[model samples]
Target: MFETVLKCTKCGKEYSLASGIYKCEKCGAPLDVQYDYDSIRDLIEDNDSWFREPPRVWKYWMFYPVSNLRKIVSLNEGGTRLYRMKNLEKKLGFGKLYVKNEGENPTGAFKDRGSSVEITKALEFHAKKVVVASTGNMAASVSAYGSKAGLEVTIVVPEGTPIGKLVQAVVYGAKIKIHGSTYDESLAESERMAREEGYYLTGNYHYRVEGQKSTGFEIFDQLRFDSPDWIVVPIGAGTHLRAIWKAAKEFYELGLIEKLPKIAGAQIEGYDAIVRAWKERKPITPIKEKKPTVASAIAVKAPVDGENVIKAIDESEGYLGAVTNEETMEAGMMLGKEGLFVEPSSATALALAKTMREEGIIDKDESVVIVATGHGLKDIKTWESFIKL
Candidate 1:
């Protein structure tokens, strides 16, 4: 059995393990699973020798919240390629550049890491079904893994999501609800179903958070260090940003790293919910249906984790930046030229870094890491418009 610890970040209350429900009863904020680290330090000290055994996220199973490895369903998600960019470094004027290429996951996106854990929890609880509201990447990831776990799956996506991702959800046989002019629109629609159907919601699930934290573990393992100088991530619903922050903070607390890296949150200007919250020092005003952008994947009008995401940014002293549709497209093309064909939303990071370079916000000599969240092929239909060849 796992240490199976659970704690409320809001109310300092603890809940029974395997509650089959995730929210804190007292405060209603999401619960984070706690693990006993008395044994973890010695166990993970020889990180390289240990990690070479399992190439996937599950390699760090002891650090993750999941208890039973056998019950865990996986698509061999995570352990994505980390590329050092001499080419991108020169262009961006950084001393070092690393791309955590997440497109190679089972569903061709980083969301697979969360999907693997969510499905495992669903199986453990014998959940009636698995459901998630996603723009593009998460819908496809949840549908694909839910299929593997033999769970009844439903995916909610915005109508304007890329055609390829929509088609994947369709062909995967998951019940699909296409709503919202944007990702947050579909999220609202999914919330209704989640409340009525008792399906496990991925974004709101503790297991998903536990599983997604593996990305941070893998990054540390890859760097052979605690963390990098900066980690640039594209944010739609802010769960990933929150997870990255959580993991890095955990590692630092456990003496893994002396310092935590700045978690840079990237957004397309029109769908910049977290950005606005950061600047104004207040809660985000919900916008249901946002206009389209080439960075369609991160185009959520209102992300559910807005408050916690801003807390992560403000507490970490991290900054936020917006990349325009034109800048996003250009950055995507530049990545393609460097042999990285990431989705436009993923390119938002590179664009932000470039903009930061101009402003001298980020020093040229610091090591920077960019998270490329999905495969470019998901939005291939729009690629012809920007492709140089």
Candidate 2:
């Protein structure tokens, strides 16, 4: 196992990996996992055989913070297809366009990637119970993984989460608590439980960010270690976009990729705190009132990783914007036409990509990749209501 340390993202404080702390004690900010990159670079340079292994989350195990291979509780997540949208490319008049379909994971959502790592780390810490707060996807994912690891799982969700998602968690045997009206409230409840009840808190923390970075790794791998011109990702808690940018920088520093791609963040109109902060060049001000939207999965009023996401976008020379529910529905239909059935939240990436291209933020001649985070089936009722089927 390579040497690792937890560094505060806000302050410069560093903690040993053995500390088992997810946030900085000094600044109360999230911590980032830092690895021994020199050894990792040497390992990759010396042996390229691991690259031939089946493309799954564990295929890039070296990049993860987990040291014990046997502790990994995986459902064979990652390695989702990166499909070239030839028809959409021509229709949208882009040089090239692709969709990294994360819906292909075991639990039919991208959250499985983080769950695999989160569960593994929980085991490493000798934790017997795990808790998470989610609008939908993460709850199902963590429940499935926790059940696989033989750990007690508790899920706290906001009111109005899609039934399809909750059913998956129920089937996985997780104790469900419908606590509050919004995701932020549920997150607070979960955190309180973790503090008082010794439950391992699992959500968009640093360890989950480590796992989510695999999406970026797979994208470069499928593209033959090449970086795209723009990579569009939908932001809820803003973890995935930050993770991808971190992955890009890691690969570049390790002498894997020559250049980094511009990261564009997508959000629904009412839940677009990060986008608003980006445009205003200020810190994120939490949204007080939550408005109903089709993209329930991304309806986060107070994004946990908003500041880092803004920093990532600014550093990458990227764009961040919000799209209306109607725009998201149109984008989802467009994806369906191409045989990719994605949830409304996932379609936000495509919606933002269209706007970017139209506004000249993303040039037509540049290669673009839109990350479709979850399957349409994850929110079937939303689709049924809009499609009249």
Candidate 3:
């Protein structure tokens, strides 16, 4: 088993693995799972035993935070393919372009990566029930994983949450509560309910982040342990970007990767707090107004971990940009022509890449990878409204 500890991202305070803490008590910052890389290095021994059998994220269990292998609640999440976009590469004049398709996950979204580990940790904590507040994709992922783990699942979402997402959560036997006007309000209520009822809040949990780190691992391994020049991802709560950043640092410390990729984030124009902060050169401030967007999955007004998102972007020597709803939809349609049916939110990566290339921010010789975080099937209504099917 890999040795691990908990560390606060903000204050750098470390805690033993036995602690049942989610956030840092001293500064209220989110906690991260710190692993003993030296021990893992000895276990790996420059071997590729992990590639012998299964094509799942658990193959990299040595890097995950869960101590007990038996408690892992997995649906064979991860192992998503990186599709080399020859057409886009030629058209955009980039050196190479690949789309990391995360839509292939169990719940048809990348959130499954985080939910699987978070649910496993919930069971390890002996939680009777697990709770989460999400706009869409995450709620469905957590509900499905929690149900499979035989734990009661509760999801709090805004009334405007996509019907497809809610249907998944409900069909998976989760208790769904529609609350507040926006995602931020619902998330606040969910946190309150978790504290009041003593339920494990898996949303934004450190283990969830650890689970997401597997994506970065897969990307590195798929590229033959060579880091890409840049990874562009769509950001809502910023967990994915932060998780990838953490994984890059961990791999570098383990001597597995020689370099780190610059991480860029794309957001919808009205709900782009992180981008606004980057442009203004100020601290991340939560967006107070919620706007309507075709990408309902990323219509988060107030991202819980906005500060860390800004930090990750800056540390990666990257910039954040916002795309209009029309641009996001156009990007999704473009990807669909390539047989990659992705939601508008997922298409934001492509949208931002197009913007950056047009603005000369990204050079022609740099290889870029865009993370498609969810399936278009989950947002069929949005797609149907615009597409002539």
Candidate 4:
């Protein structure tokens, strides 16, 4: 209820909350849900009970734009574990290292966090059907959530999407459509369906960004409201990194945290548009050709939130880089040794972190948290090829 308006990230245009618009009409850019921060601050100050609530997405309801808490379509997502990688720390020669394991969420990926909010909003708008495009993770997450909410879910996936992920969506009763060879093509088809068929579009939009911010909130909470020196995340559409940074700034402004953490984004080499843009100081350009990689989940050729992600990194004085498939596999093995099994995309965070530490871009003594975005089992076929039984 504290949400006041939807503001354009590019043109500074504003729309009422009831307008039901997700993008800027004037500039064709994404819109963010703006809230009454003073009211939120006062509410938090007056009530301390919410802090004692179980650490889940709904626990931070005040930060979300949902008008009805009871109607929330949740799979008990969020509050994933923040683990200290003591063994890796010693081996890698780092001062402090931790992994925010998002793999533990329902449906075994961080996409569940976004789907929880998106589905709830879908029902609030009286939507009977929802559509989403994904390389893998989001489709499964949204399918599960829509099933729970009794909404018809249509999933559009690119060819070569991991079978493990598609099976999850199929089991959840989603109508599957394999659209094109690349994720961008699948997204175009989904968008067209949303426009023509009146289906509620779900993906890396503003509402999902609101939900995904909980990853950062939980990290800060687990750290007892303290900010880490760096929080590394793998970027696909670039939404997760931007969401984390937005959460950090919100917490800092609300006096919940004293300092902001530097945001680091990792991408597979061929899908490194945002990283290239950051290094070259140029606008993000789409990768025209698709290259094969084990990290299919994060293999986005044209990141939807690339511009905003760059702004977040620049604002936080962070680093962005890409790593090879071999390096990612090694990183995945390293995480497995640490008692964590993550997909190649998730392991990219660790690969980038190690590279940064060795290059002296990241100091050895700084506390670091790598946001492992998905479970290794989500892409069992890819794991089978690189990791022998």
For residues 225-246, could you state the per-residue lDDT of candidate 2 as single tens digits? 8999999999998999999999
Q: lDDT by residue for model 3 over 126-222, one digit each (tens)?
A: 8989888875788889999999999889898777666666888899889988899776678778778777888888887788888898888888888
lDDT tens string, model 4, 282-336? Answer: 8888998879998988888888889999999999999999999999999999999
Estimate candidate 2's RMSD in Å: 1.4
Model 2 CA deviation exceeding 4 Å by range? 158-165
Misplaced by over 4 Å in model 4 are 158-164
Task: Please give each candidate's TM-score.
Answer: 0.90, 0.97, 0.95, 0.97
Model 2 pairs whose backbones collide: none
On TM-score, the stronger of 2 and 3 is: 2
Candidate 3 total steric clashes: 0
Which pairs, if any, clash in model 3? none
Query: Residue 302 of candidate 1: its Cα lDDT?
Result: 62
lDDT rank order = 4, 2, 3, 1
Per-candidate count of clashing residue pairs (backbone under 3 Å): 0, 0, 0, 0
Each model's lDDT: 0.79, 0.90, 0.85, 0.90
TM value for model 2:
0.97
Q: Which regions in candidate 3 have their CA more than 4 angstroms from the true location? A: 1-3, 51-55, 159-164
